[model samples]
Target: MTTLNALHQLDLDHHIHPFTNLAGHQSRGPLLIDHGDGPFVVDAQDNRYFECVSGLWSAGLGFSEHRLADVAYAQMKRLPYYHSFTHKAHSPGIELAAKLVELTPETLNHVFYTNSGSEAVDTAVKMVWYVNNALGRRGKKTFLARRLGYHGSTVASGSLTGLARVHDDFDLPAIPVRHLTTPNYGKEARPNETEVEFTTRLGQEMQELISHEGAGTIAAFIGEPVMGAGGVLPPPVGYWTMVQRICKEHDILLVLDEVITGFGRMGRMFGLEYYGITPDILVLSKQLTSSYQSLGAVIVSDELHDVLVRQSAQHGSFGHGFTNTGHPVATAVALETLRIIETEDLVANAEARGAQLRAGLTLLEDHAAVLSSRGAGFLGAVELVPDGPAGAAGLKAFEIAHKHGLILRAVGDALVFCPPLISSEAQIDQMLAALRLVLDDCA
Candidate 1:
């Protein structure tokens, strides 16, 4: 039998963790999560922790959701696996696509499935290029992203992502892409500048970049309505509006990466609705199946969909798909996940709980080690005062919070929070209480 130490040794020898420093991981070891309940998880040693990060900003239905488990089992028994390729289709996949179309904005009516957000992003890039080629716009191949934006980690998607870590040493940005300024008013906006002024400046900056690159060469501008993994920064007012207008004027497509903010994280069915901005392509994952299963989708606009259809008719076929393009089991789980989100009204719950969380964190703005607090909906972050370097203080705070029975993430000094959508008012209070104790102890 595998003892705990044996399991640890096995992991240390074989496991290659993502987004981790390998040497440091070998030294520190892994946190073995044995089980979970509601919004909390228990380690192998029976240590319980409030899941403040919602399992990498997914798991909206929380841990131990039997509904999702049962659905998976039922689907497995009925039709465990099937492929949607060569004009073949399945009910779960077809129904899920229809449901997503119904839930999203009107123009976004077509859904293309992938197994993860990374693949969805890559697919969106390919679709943009394909549509441009179909329109005889061969020169429009460049992609515009923002300095801190995160799309995914695939070769092309990583190129679209603007974070340096996603690029460093990977020799990425393998494609022709340019990154613009992040619309983080708290960090980037100048002193005494109004929100309008900031928005205009960023818009002008984007326009300038477009002009520098020649608008004919740029294919699309991809961004997150609420930039996640980049410190949970919410867009400033008028940011998305100006960006959308710019895309229209330049004839560049607008691709919103909703991998982190989709499925009711932003107090709306979609983050685009929350900001009142539309997009040409919508990349989705993470919460689509509430992370119960691996599934993703790229929802395209009617205009682009028509172009792709024409392209396919002109050529022999579209020539793009995966082995599990719309795996029956994954889609079935996603269908049930959507039902739960809608039936439970978790979107509204996120709004209410987000308000409570923001209020509680705002009170910490005066703390000696806290720099500021900012968030929207159930997603939020508290920037810690840098002790010496940027991540130093935040790292300490994160360790303290863990000791206080909370699981939190520190992206540099900005500690991000994304609790499950099903969290009760009392659970939210408990999260805040844990944070308070950690802050006091650290202070």
Candidate 2:
């Protein structure tokens, strides 16, 4: 056997892949990746596949950017690791923090580093409790998240996540986190309800929850600006505006989880910008380093930062930080990534290409198997209904597309596509062609 085959066999025997069926994977073996070039990743057998999901919706700059590699090399030569605890810091971390404050929503000014989105979300949850403790509101501890919202996979963050599979067999949701309705028009909207009325009803349901739970006892309301892992569902018109107003009126902290929607994924630098809402605390990851490295950030508003500072001074140090927090290599890579996004105008590109993607995917809506197509910028999903004995056609479409040199993801019965921001119009067309073939094959 070749080295690649040997490696795959070893991996199948030794590794436990995340979110995968272990026994099935053992039978099939892993798709051992050897290299990548410009939106395409090659397996050990030299078979190339278009990475439609952006390698878990994180590789916004694509896979073969030498600039990112150079940044990592330079940072590793200088300082590879560092902790951001007890006022200790490094140059790359400090500079990246400054850039984040400048680039994020104006209300957000403080940046807390974490190793991943899960850690960032867990940190946000702790901060909510800490802030309430500082303010002497001991009763404010419960958190409210939307039913389809995906925050992270850590204990607290996973509890905040509303996906059922993430909770099954994990004994998760260890904390008191309430889940509300997801605003998926196809799945949840009533026959007579307009999008506007649906949004209003959801907002009212939130208001009712606040009243029932006692506003004094609720700490924060966490949600993605556009539900990504829940199947890339964007909010209805005026949905976030109403949600923000309700949160403010109830004095509940609004925590926007932008792990998947941040860094130009939603045609803007942040989903909050797309939705026109100013959150008090924001969770960011994924596209921050563009999967070049593992890094996450919890951005706090000036108000929350002030409160945290005061509380820390009174009690002691903040007393929370990860060992790899503000890792120099990751920070340097992220800094260069952001610079590339700005210099290359990738955000604008995502907006333009996103329109083309949406337009192309919209054509699929006429297909008998397709139920709906929803997207914002490059992130999108096509919901499929059961056609014949295949059950969920979208899932079969995903597998078919994968075999046809395209890697797509299926969330429930929906096929999700989140291509890189650097993707060209031709690449978008190629993706659509592959998708069309898959859909036709499925039919």
Candidate 3:
């Protein structure tokens, strides 16, 4: 076995991690994760810690699920490689597509495959534009997104993403998109604004933006059901209702980027279902295969799919997709992943465990370091009363959390948590206890 020192040196010499500060990593080195056991990840030194963010908000079944591995092994042996391009097709891809359409709303009856959530978002953008062009609405190319809503890191998708970190030096939003205010009551609400009033104002802002941008020029409005990367901000009351009404009122396509909230993260199969609103396009990834394989799907309404059909007929093929658009093994794993989610009823587990988590975070609100707590289902966040700068307290708590045997993601002063759907009540208690100790140290 390679020594930890040797491994660390090799990683430092070669690896370029995403969404990490390269300069800091060079000085601090990597926390080499050797393996995963249930909801816990084991470091190279055999130290175990709860992966609270579920490996970037994926990993619905946690790590080390042998069933997924077994399915992958079997699928590899049967048909390790195949692509869904041209006129050729494979059973796994076809079956998975069928399953997705079945799971989605009746209006969204078609599925397009991609390799990642970013790619799925990009695909959705292209599909929406293609549909508009087919319908001869060439001017409808602008997209409306939220300031903090996270879409993906690809060109078009990253443009949909509203984070400065994701945009800095990246020269993104390569597509024409408008960003609105984040629907965060904690951070954006007025001094004396009530929740209902905040929601009303936000809804009005969307309507006003549509009018200002000219509804005929807007292609779609995309957002996360619960803004995950943007500090786990759930929409204010009546926000989705208003967004849906405006989209329908102006014939703008509604796109829900459910990559983080899909497949039981929000205690439902999809975030749209959790929020009780329908979208013309639903983007999915991350938990699609429990992150065992890289795969994503863009499910579009039947109306849009018909436009795609007509456009493709004129354009010769859709003129979109990846080399591994519908890789056989990835699709096979997704099918098995969905089966496990249903068989184990992990959605219900998320709801029950989420209740416990929310209650625990609510208790933490009394802590001197904590200003407030909020979340939905298994997604939660606790904003700290930072003693120093804007993000100092949150960063300190994240570092201290490691010592307490926990891993949490920080978006500024907000420490967000997303434990695996399979995490137990005991594990949840352990996580909360570790968090309490970490908070005490931060305080």
Candidate 4:
């Protein structure tokens, strides 16, 4: 990207954007961002907009976090790149791994690095299979996932993802996996059903799925602690408790994909703490480095780690990894990012500001188009009364928000909001005001 013209031209000629309507992109072009400060992003023409969704729900420290930038710069100058394979190690990788083990849940003392959430999940899948195989339960190769859960786009991780768009025309679930009903009580619950009943019903469905596939064949159950791309849907009451019990009963490993809810986004160090559920594998990314660097980690429990070691020793190597796995510069940035999150007490801030954000969304419930609000911690969404096709209203609101100097993404008919954890009460109010303007403009 030499200049604005050259960048746009290059995008037009070569860059195919992800999750975008290709035909629409041809005409609409790109919303080129010039720079950012705190939780706000400025467009090329100096149009300032609150980054409501935090750049795909990744940039928790917003765009201009100097500490992360400085660390990355210094690391690059010293030792830019190194691999964790073949017994080779770097200080950044070693120190960051220890720090992660200290921060993550107990028993999950092992860290495996990947470049993205998808790869981390892919690694997790392989780990599950390997563990079962090591124990001579080769038939336990199937995975359990939730419908509408967003995991990632890689072959293995995409298979775990239950979104229709991800599987559309892609012939996915290419792996051995079973998807249960989405635990979206607001949308999926029977009329007059209690939240507890809805949760029990979902639990039954899981049991039925496991039964149909045979318990010995189901290796793992994967889900987001609070579903992210499925329209900011939080778990129903008793959902996690029921899910964990069933997984333990069946000897199946539980995996939590906390790509969006990790770090301080959930107002806790990790989502497991919020839900009081322990996972055998914790998939982390996004806010891990606050998206300052593309670093991901799959934290494994001690029990599973022992199996991995025995199996790998038998095979002479794990035979799975990436070239950029635990890249020094990325690890350095992630270390600093975690340090800042601790010292600044961003998790507490998220809890406080998240209350404000949720209240703001509830106030918007009085809007003609808004049906209701849903969220926890720093994540929230407003379900709109669809005008025509599903999600059309959300897309409209998303576009109209720009006119009010706000940038938020719409998930289906649910307009989602996930501001940086560093956002203040004033910024939250400003975001709400802009969103109210968008809703009014829609009317």
Candidate 5:
């Protein structure tokens, strides 16, 4: 049998990673994850650690979900794979689409599948351009995103992402997209500024940008209800309402990138429902199948779908899709995942556990290294005071947590925690205990 060191050498020799420093990895090697158990993962040497970030914030059902495995197996045996393109379809695709439509806001009635969140973002962007071209509004080509908002890391979607790191060496923002202010009240809100006042300021800035750019030149505005990878920053009170109103006034499409916030992560079926805003386009992934399989969907409104249909009639084909657009196995797993979430009442559990997490973290706000505790549902983050450099403090906290057998993500100076939705109060307390220890060590 091949030894673990030999395997590690093989990985270091041949494997390329994303968003990673290759040189650093070559020297230290990768942290080899062998397997998982519920909300925890085991390293190659059998070191078990709590999975606080839920496997990149996608595993809402956690690890070792037999139902998801069973569903995938059943679908593979029944009808391994099929394409939604060229008029060919499968039951899994049809049923998953219908279920998504039923769960989303009434405005979104059509579903377009992709292989990942990045692809979903590209699909949404393409749809906007396609619909505008079909409607003879070619000038409406630019997009308005927000700084620190993470969409995805594809050509077009990466362009839509407003984070500098994503664009720095990539020559990104490749498309005509402008970034606005993120709706983070903790750091961005002016001193003594009321929530309503902060919202108004943001709204005014958006309207001014639209007027300056000429609304006809803008196609859509994309944002996450809560900025995830950029930092788990929830919107200021009434922020979405004001932004939605502005989009309507200018006829710019509102695209909600719920890749992280969707699938009950925010204690709601969809973040739009929580905020009471109906977007023109919705991008979903991550927990869609609890990351058991790579899948994503772009839900569009009837009005936009009609335009695409008419365009197809005129142009003979829509000319957009992937071979695995609606893979049977992926959709099957997603369906079963949704069933589990609903039947297990994980949404309600997320609400309860999220409250507990926020409260526990709030108690640490007075710690010397802590700055703020912010979250919604099971998604939360702690901004730490910078010690040596920008990411120094957050990195220290992460290392300390890992030493205690807990997993957390350090994004810049923020330590983000997103546990499984099904986590019990006891598990919540255990996580809190780990966090408390990290807090003291960092202090």
Candidate 6:
């Protein structure tokens, strides 16, 4: 067995982790995660931590799932690898696509596979352009996104992401991508502005941008139903509905980035369903495979799909695919993962436990350090105010929570919590209790 120190050295010497401070991590050494059981993961020294972020908000079934292992192993034994190109197909891919079509919004009838969320978003961008081009609207090339909204990290997707940190030094926003204000009532709301008024104003802002840029120049407007990496800001009431209406009025394609909110994370299979809005294009990833495998998909409306098919036929081929676009092993695991979510009634569990979690965390609203507690289903965040000279109170709280046996992530001044969908009532209580203790200690 490799020693902890040896593993740390190896990681420091070679592995470059995403969203990490490389030099700081190299000096402090990485957290050597050894294994996981249920909702808990153990470090190299066997210290268990409640994985509140669910392994970067993807491990929907949590860790230590024997069924996923069995599915992956069986698929490996049968057929380890294959490509989905030139009409080639596999059983798992076909089945998963059918199930996804069934589960997604009624309008999203066709699915295009990708190896990751970034690839899926890139593909969606291409599809939108292709569709517009096919319809003879070549000037409708601009894409509109919301400020602080995150899509993915590939070239086109990264440009679509509105986070400054994601664009710094990258020379991004490369193409015709524009951003509207984030609909964060807590931070963006004006004094005396009600949630409904804020929603109206946000819609007006979108309309203003569209008018200024000329709606005919814009191809699509992309947004997350609930802004995830932008600090878990669920839209105020009537936000999505009005946005959808605006898009329809302007003939703009609406692309919902459901990377974080899809597959029952928001107590619905799709965020669009929860928000009661349908989109021309929908992007899905993260929990689709429950982190059991790396896979993502872009579900298109029938109209868009028809245009894409015609365009591709005219062009000879689509000219977009990854080597592992629909890897059999990943698809097999995803198929089984979806089955587990269905059979275990995990979506219902997420709804129930999410209520418990919200209730428990809301009790901390009076805590001097906590500014707000907001959540939808199992995804939530606690915004904090800076204490003392440093504006690192949220980061400090994150460290304190980790030391107290819960893994939490910080987005600016917010403590983000997205536990596994299978998290039990006791685990929810444990998570809150850990936070309470950490807050008390920090105070």
Which regions in candidate 4 have their CA more than 4 angstroms from the true location?
Answer: 1-3
Count of residue pairs whose backbone atoms collide, per candidate:
0, 0, 1, 0, 0, 0
- TM-score for predicted model 5 compared with the true structure: 0.98
Which regions of candidate 2 are displaced past 4 Å?
388-391
Which ten residues in a row are the worst by lDDT in model 3? 268-277
TM-score of each: 0.99, 0.97, 0.98, 0.98, 0.98, 0.98
Model 2: pairs clashing at backbone N, Cα or C within 3 Å: none
lDDT of 6 by residue, 175-247 (tens): 7898988989988999999999999999889889889989889999999989888788888989988998999
- lDDT (tens digit, per residue) of candidate 1 on 333-413: 999999999999999999999999999999889888788999998899999888878798888888888788999999998
Q: Provide the RMSD of all predictions against the true structure, rounded to 1 decimal.
A: 0.9, 1.5, 1.0, 1.0, 1.0, 1.2
Tens-digit lDDT track of model 2 for 1-443: 56866788789878899988888898877877889899999987788899999999999999999999999998888887777777788999999999999998788889998989999999999999999999999999999998888998889999989988889999989988899999776678998999999999999899999899899999999999989988899888899899889989989999999999899987888888888889999999889999899999999999989989999999878888889999999999999999999999998999998999999889989877688898987788888877555435665787788778899898877889899999999999998888888888877
Q: How many clashing residue pairs, candidate 1?
A: 0
RMSD of 4: 1.0
- Per-residue lDDT tens digits for candidate 3, residues 1-443, read 88889999998999998988899999999999989999999998888989999988999799899999998999999999987788889999999999998888889888889999999999999988889988999999999999988998988999999988888889987899999999998889999999999999988898898888898899999999999999999988888998898889999999999899999988888888877889999999999999999999999888888889988999788898788999999999999999999999999999999999999999999999999999998899999997688898888988989888998899899999999999999999999999999999998
After TM-score superposition, the amount by which residue 440's alpha carbon in candidate 6 deviates from its true location, in angstroms, is: 1.1
Candidate 1, clashing residue pairs? Answer: none
Cα lDDT tens digits for candidate 5, 1-443: 77899989998999998988799899978888989889889998998898998988899888889999999999999999988888999988999999999999888999999999999999999999999999999999999999999999999999988888899989897899999988888888899999889999999999999999899999999999889998899899999889889999999999999999898888888888888889999999999999999999999999999999999899899999998998999999999999999999998888888899889888878888788888886788888988988898887888788788898999988998889887889998998888888888998
Error of 5 at 199 (Å): 1.1
